[model samples]
Target: MSDLLRLATAGDVDDGKSTLVGRLLYDTKSVLADQLDAVTADSALSTPDLALLVDGLRSEREQGITIDVAYRYFATPRRSFVLADTPGHVQYTRNTVTGASTAQLAILLVDARKGIRGQTRRHAAVLALLGVRHLVLAVNKIDLVGYDESTFTVMAKQFAAHAAGLGYPRDAVTAIPISALRGDNVVDRGGRTSWYTGPTLLEHLESVHTAPDPDQTPLRFPVQYVIRPRSAGCPDYRGYAGQVAAGVVRCGDEVAVLPSGLRTTVAGIDTPDGRLVEAPAGQSVTLLLEHDLDVSRGDMITAADAPPALTDEFDATLCWLGDRPLRRGTRLLVKHGTRTIPAIAQELLVRLDEQALSLCGQPGELVLNDIGLVRLRTAEHVPIDDYDTSRATGSFIVIDPADGSTLAAGLVGADLPIQ
Candidate 1:
């Protein structure tokens, strides 16, 4: 199997995010001939409109803006890619958060002429808060600015400082000057940016470590479904089915079920491909335990030595995506992994000021697209780990009780009360 890398792009509107994505696809010859023909026929200009490759929505073409997160998949000789083209409008910040939540690396675009804007800063802060450790500040549209080295230098320093202030390590952040429109430093190094001698955007993406190896993390497998075969051919078959959230598990490994504090040994690990000696994170498999201890969907199975905390109340940080303001005592359903439990917005904590990167004095409620620290109380005990420890077990979403609309994306222990 080929190595896969997941990444997302974020920046302010008109920062050429869609165009950059289009250029990557076009330059890499990932676009089909018919798709290119359609774009060419649709374009009013002499040249084909590359943005049309990704801006698939008719509304997007009509308005000339990206409103939803568009995902594209392609591969090169070295690696395969799953790229998310996120919207840049401040109103669509929720989309940006959704796109970057699972991204191992993010390419944050900035208009070479406009340095880092408020929305850029907000996106950067959100990426860092979501635990994305690798960042590429792609300073795009260099052609419009005369390809000046000083321009790139100044903007690079400013963004580096902002990323550092937001708690991102300087070494983890890379600033690349490019013109996504002209394809400079995107797929190849163009002559215009001779002064900027750095790896191209593609180079950094191919080389950056996606995330900590799953085998190095603790085991966290949230049981999704219980499998029990009643047929006479396998009358006694009982297994727990789910995707391994983190770490590795093997037959005969001692495991513990969370919330119930029951312990069992792994009797077997099975898949359609047949029995497996071991399974790693991201693999979907069924596990048979030595003793059935009432395991069900939503219960977590973890290595005995490193079980997650089972708690009903904890402080969490959330990116409020609800239309209605989120105030204290708001009741909702918290969906963690495969488990859905009644929960209440126990308290309204501090809200993060995107510009200042500081907490605003206690707010009575969080409005749309507001990133705030809040306390949540669940109806039953749920197993969880800190967002930093394991993204799989540490993140959750709040659903509106009345309509089931997703309201917020939450990270456990994202923000602790000021000391």
Candidate 2:
């Protein structure tokens, strides 16, 4: 099992994501004494407002809402955690995407009173598109609904069905009742509901397995830098420095430099500690090739036998995030891996209707927070993969060249059904 777990909390506004995170931090004894003291002193209530611990922004605290992705780190004896508390408002759905982009799991909260809302379904669809494998449906504020067990059960079944329709397996979704404010079933299984006999939120987080082993996937190493330091100990050291995005790389493995399709053998793997005989996915190392090639940043090094396709055109699912509307012929930059290329929105196929949980037939333009299917044409052929096959190689960002701001988050070859 991996020692670190990356997760995110998301839902509608006032869903208590911050409070849940703060409770996790507090109950796990992860907060510093001075930090606790400050929050305690700042609170007007008898007890410190736990939400203040995560709602760090003055605007968020003042408005009593989360507007950005707030990341928190804490640990228990069993494992460490990095949780992103994402904003829930419809306009800030982009932040939720940013927060959950790399998360292996997501805690999708629902008010026991509201049941399943449109934004909830939309967020669930976006999580599916992002390929987040594990999901926890946290039916929060059960106290508001008089701690009705049937209400929780009905919501869980409804969400489970929706998640299933979105391609999540039965075992991938787990539902738990929680009250972030009261600290029930968060870190501990409180006595409020003896009718429920499931693990606490923290217990589930600690035990749940997530994501397939990256080492089992094909090798994908995008060269971030080329190292050729001329030193006394190593006068002729030439290596490609990058993080192994997927699969295992061994010393003798034959690798292919992408776009150029130049083949070479892995001469060795070097790190700051020393040379390594083999390096697996997620490890950053300097790769020594048998033959020196014109490798640079944006070029990918992959297993020679299973190289990704080089293409100038591909279909993508885009989450439109720009303040201005997006339409066909909108010239933008597609930042894939480390490569940036000029691209145009060739066609806007359809937009996702969050209310109906279906695709809009002929949406000509996409506004902020509108997710749609688009055909992108790049200026040059770039190495890309299917998102379901390799997230590291298949994801790209659409950026506005004028202001150098990100306009959209894209997934290559993923046209997920909203339903």
Per-prediction count of colliding residue pairs? 0, 0
In candidate 1, what are the lDDT values of residues 167-211, reduced to their tens digit? Answer: 777789999999998899999998988887889998877777665
The number of the candidate with the highest TM-score is 1
Predicted model with the maximum lDDT: 2
What is the Å distance of residue 212 in model 2 from its true position?
A: 3.0
**Lowest summed lDDT over 10 consecutive residues: which window, candidate 1?**
208-217
Clashing pairs in 1: none
RMSD, every candidate, angstroms? 2.2, 2.1
lDDT digits (tens) for residues 298-393 of candidate 2: 899999999998999999999888999999999999999878999999999888875466778667899998888999999999999988788888
TM-score for all models, in order of appearance: 0.94, 0.93
Q: What C-alpha lDDT do the candidate models reach, one value each?
A: 0.90, 0.90
